[model samples]
Target: MRLMDSSEAITIKDVRSARRRLEGSARVTPLLEDPHLNAIAGRRVLVKAECLQRTGAFKFRGAWSALTALGEGARERGVITYSSGNHAQGIAHAAEELGIPATIVMPDDAPALKLANTRGYGAEVVLYDRAGGQSREEIGNRLAEARGLTPVLPYDEPLVIAGQGTAGLEIAGQARAMGVTKAEVLVCCGGGGLSAGMAVALAAEAPGLRVRTVEPAGFDDTARSLAAGERLGNEPGASSICDAILTPMPGELTFPILSRLAGPGLAVTDDEVLRTMGLAFQRLKLVTEPGGAVALAAALFHGAELADGPVVALISGGNVDTAMFRRALDMLDAAEPGAA
Candidate 1:
C-alpha cells in the first residue's frame, strides 16, 4: 500500500474501514450512564467503558485493525511491539486469534495483571527497565529486525490510529441513540492515537462534538504540546501511578491530527485518579485502572472548564494490579467525608 501524507494518513474513510474490519471481532462496549457521575459533573455524563472490551481495553480494536491490514506475508513473519500493558495484551490477543507469532517488550513496572494477561494471550514477553536508560522502541525494533517480524507500534501508525477510531464511531452512534446532540469527549492521552483517531471520527460523524485529551499531571506531554503548538517531551524522571498512559512524548503522526482537531488538553493528579477509580468501583460498579480513570477524573473535577454540554469520558482500560486496586480503595476509605 502506498503511504499517504502524514496529515492525511488516518482519514474518516480509514476509520470507517476499520469499523467494518472490527465489526464482529471487536465488542461495541457499552456507553454507561452514571447518576453519581452526572451529579458530580452537574451535567449529563456518559462513560465509554472500554475497560470491558476484549483484552480488557480498547487497544484490541487498533491491534486487530493494524494486523488485519497487514499482508499475509507480514502476518507469517510475526509482529513485535512495546507497551506498558494494555497495548501489549491487545496485540498479543489479536496475534493469537490470527495464528501469528507475537512478541512484546514491556516495562518491568507494568501492572502485574496486564503483564500476566499479555503473556496469557500467547505473546513472548521481554521485560525492560524503564530507569535503566534502555529505549523500548529501539529494543522492539532490534528484536523485530532479528526475527524478521513486523513492528507494531503502540501508537503513531495510521492503521492503528484508524482502528482506535472505531471506538469513536461507536461513541457517536451511542450518544445519538441517547439523545445527545452535542457533547465534549474526554479521552486518556498517551501518544495521541486514540485522541487523534477519535477526533477524525467525531469530526465526520458528530460534528458538534469536541475532543479533549486527558493525562496524568506530571506526564501531560500531549497537553503541553498542544498549548505550545509543537511536539514536546516529558521529564525523563517524571513518574505517576497511572502507568498505562505514561508515554514520554506525543507521537509524531498522531500529534498533527490532534493539533488540528482536538481542544485544549486537561490533566489530573494521581490522588484524583485513585479517588476516581475508587468511585468508579463503588458507584459505576466498574473496575477502572488509574490510567483509564484519568479522563473520568478530568470530567469529575474539571468538567466545567472542558465543556458546558453533556460530557463523555472514555475509560480506556481496567488492568490494575490487585494490590494497587486495594490501595485505591483504601485511599477512598481514608478520604474526608463526601470526598469521593
Candidate 2:
C-alpha cells in the first residue's frame, strides 16, 4: 500500500476529528509533570503517558480512528491487520467495542502479554515465524486474502497515520492547558505513522515547536532515511534491545513530514534505553518498554538541545517481557559505580 504524501496527506484537523469521534472511548492520558525527571535532566520534562492509553499504548488512538472511519459495509466485512503486538490489541479492542469481528496476524516473537490481550478482546489470532523468512506483510496479506477480511495496516495507510496523529494532537491540547505553547516533542517512531501524524498535528498547532523522534541505536532507519531523503529499509536481523523499533524504513507519508516537522530521529543505546526505562518507573511511576524509553533516553543523555523541553516524551508502550523487564530494572540497579 502507498503511504500518504506529506503535501497531500490529511491534516491534523482530520486527526482531531478522529479523536472527537473516539470521544470518551480512548483515554486522554495524563500529561505528567515529572519533578524527578526534571531534576535529573536539569530541564523541564513532561511525559504524555500514552502507556496509560487503552491497550496500554497509543495504538488505541489509531486503531479506534481507523475502525470508526470505516463505513457500515466495511465494518460488516470485519477487519484484519498485522502487528508486533500492541496494534493487534488496539485493533481488536476497537473492533470488539464497535461490535465488529477482528483478526490479527502477529509475530510469534511478539510479546506474550500483548498476544493474550488481543485474544482477550475476542479477535482471532494467527501467528507466524519471524525466522521463517516469510515477511510479516506477506503473512498478513495472505491471511486477509484467504479469509476475505479487510486488512488494516499497522502504520502504512493514510487513515491509519491520520488516526495515530491524534495522540500528538491531544498532546498539543494538553501542552496548551498546562500553560505551554511549545517545546520539543519526542515521539517514539518505528515505521513513522505516529511520528508523522504528530509532526503534522504539532506543526500546524504549535508552529515553532520541534517534534523530534527517537529510535533504537542499531535500528536507526528513521534517522538515516531523513538524512538520505529516501525510504531506507532495515538490515536483515538488525537486533535491538528495544524490539519495537526494529523497522527498517520510515513510511512514505511519514518521511517528508518527519524531516520537515521533526529535527531528526535521534538514536539511543540499549543501555540508555534500560536506564530510561528504570528512571521512568522510579520517577514517572510509569511502565515503559525499551522502545518507549528511547525518547526519555535522549532527554537524559542529550539534554538541553532536545528541548528546554517542557518536553513530552511520548512513552510509547508498556508491554515488555517479564524477564526483560526485570533485566531493565537490574540494569538500573547496576547503573552506578557498584552492584546492588
Candidate 3:
C-alpha cells in the first residue's frame, strides 16, 4: 500500500477513467455563489455543494468507483468498509443499487441520520466504540476475513481517490464557466481522499486552481502533516464535533499526491464550523454537517490565510440529524451580529 511517489499513485488519467465509470451514477453537484457569503469573506466565494450529492455526501463517487472496479466475481462476493457516517451511507447506497451485499462498520456515536440512512440503504451495520479504544479497521478486517468480503478502504484505496477526483473535474469546468481562472479550492479532509483526488484532477484540468485541505481544529492531522513535510498522526483521543473528517492520519496513497499538488492546509474551530453550517442553511439553503462545513468555515473566517482570489469551498456532506441542525442554527446570532 506504499505510494512512494506521485507518478506511481493516482494521476489525472486515473481520475478521467473514474469519471467515465461514474458517468450516469455520480451527480455533478453545483458550484454556487452568494453575495452574502462574498461579503462575509470580503472576496468572491464559490461553494461546491457536494452536500447535495447522493446519500447526502460526495463519498458516493468513490464508493461506486471502487465497487464497480472490482470484477463481477468479487462484487457478488460482497464488500466491507469502515466509516463514521458519510462513507457508510455512500457504500451502502451504491451497494444496494448494484445489488451487491455490503457491510459497514460505524462508530456507535455516529449521527442518528447517518446511521439510519446507512441501514436504510440495505447494508448490514456493525457498531464499534470509537471513544473506548476500539479500532474500526480491526473490526472491519475481522468481519471481512470471516465473511469473505472484499475490503473497500474508505480513503486509502486508489480507486476511491480517483473517483473523488471527478468532483475536481467538474469544479474546474464550473469555475471556468463562471469566469474564475485562479483560486484556492478548500476541501474538508478526513484522510485526504477528496482533496488529493481533486488536486490530481485540477493539476491537469485547471492548473490555476489549487487545493487546500481544511479540518476541524483538534483533528487537523492533514494540515500538520503538510506543515511537517511528512506524515503525522493526530493526538490520541482528540475529539471534535466534526466527526466526518476526523482521521488518525492521512492515507498512505493520498499524502504523496497532496504533498505534491495541494497548497498549505487549513484548520477551523468547531464554533466556526457550526457558524458556517448555520450560514449555509440561512444563506444558501443548504444543510451542512459540522465535518462537512470545515472548508466553508475556512472560506469565511480564515480568509486571511487564503490566497488572494476567488475561494472555492467544498461543503462535503449534509447528513446531519435534526438536533445537530438545530444546534447549528442556534449559533446563527453569534455567527453574525444582526442575522435573524
Steric overlap count per candidate: 0, 1, 0
Sorted on lDDT, best first, the list reads 3, 1, 2
Which tens-of-lDDT digit does each residue in 313-335 have in candidate 3? 99978888888888888888654
Q: What does candidate 2's lDDT look like per residue over 140-173, in tens digits?
A: 7776677667777777777777778888777888
Model 2 misplaced regions, further than 4 Å? 1-8, 304-309, 337-340
The all-Cα superposition gives candidate 3 an RMSD in Å to the true structure of: 2.1
248-289, model 1: which lDDT tens digit per residue? 889999999999999999999998898899989998889988
Which sections of candidate 1 miss by over 4 Å?
Answer: 1-8
Residue 315, model 1, lDDT: 96
Q: Model 2's lDDT to the true fold? A: 0.80
Model 2, residue 171: distance off in Å is 1.8
Between 1 and 2, whose lDDT is larger? 1
